[model samples]
Target: MSQIPLEHILLLSAVLFCLGLLAVITKRHAVVVLMGVELIFNAANLNLVAFSRYDPSLLQGQLFSLFVIVVAAAEAAVALAIVLRVYQHFKTANLNEIATIDK
Candidate 1:
């Protein structure tokens, strides 16, 4: 069976991670930041699965990826709940605007 090169997968993962980092660093919206966090999680998952495919002796990588996915889902739910509350209370979802402690 044909297989993808490890380098290609790693490169894609790196690009995804960089884009996610950029979004997390530059975006001011809470939702966008959450999405960026999800992207990073996905990139890590991709790497884990790719490595697992290369070495079939153990399925630890795939299992860990599954765990990460589960955690990411739970995180999304809680994070969205918090974001919604912040928006309702502050009248805006902008992280920069809501970051003020004096309000």
Candidate 2:
């Protein structure tokens, strides 16, 4: 069986990172921004897995990736909760509108 190239894997990771950055920068909705952050995390995870494939130990990369996944899940939950509260308090999820918190 032919194995995939490391360069290709890194390229995919780069693409994912860029897309996530674009989403975070261009989107105004809090949920969309959260999704973007998740994308970035996924990209990092992919890189970790890919690099782990080349390592002799083989376990370190996968273990780190698993840890990252757990942290990301927790972060997403807390972030969504915060977003929900913000929406409840402000009646809008747009980040720009939420900036005017003095009202």
Candidate 3:
């Protein structure tokens, strides 16, 4: 099987990472930011899997990525729960509004 160049995979991952960072930075909605965080996690997973393809001996990279996926799932669950509670309390999911409410 012809494999894609590592550089290409890395570049794709970098682009995804950057886009996620931008969303996290520019978005005010809690849910949107959470989605951005997911994107970043996915980018990391992509890198891990890509590297593991090259080194198939132990598949440690794939194993690590699996752990990361589990952690990300847990984080997303907790974060959405918090967002739900915050929306109930503040009537808005905007981070700026939530911050102002705490003061």
Tens digit of lDDT per residue, candidate 2, span 1-103? 9979999999999999999999999999999999999999999999999999998676888999999999999999999999999999999999999997766
Error of 3 at 90 (Å): 0.5
TM-score for each model = 0.95, 0.95, 0.96
- List pairs with backbone clashes in candidate 2: none
Error of 3 at 16 (Å): 0.6
lDDT for residue 13 in candidate 1, whole number 0-100 = 99
Model 3 CA RMSD to the hidden true structure, in angstroms:
0.9
Residue-level error in angstroms, candidate 1, position 71: 0.3
RMSD of each: 1.1, 1.1, 0.9
Report the C-alpha lDDT of model 3 over 1-103, residue by residue, as the tens digit: 8889999999999999999999999999998999999999999999999999898897899999999999999999999999999889899999998888878
Which residue runs does candidate 2 get wrong by more than 4 Å?
A: 101-103
> Where's the lowest-lDDT run of ten residues in candidate 3?
94-103
lDDT of 2 at 98: 90
Residue range 3-99, candidate 1, lDDT tens digits: 8899999999999999999999999999999999999999999999999988999999999999999999999999999989988899999988888
- TM-score of the candidate numbered 3? 0.96
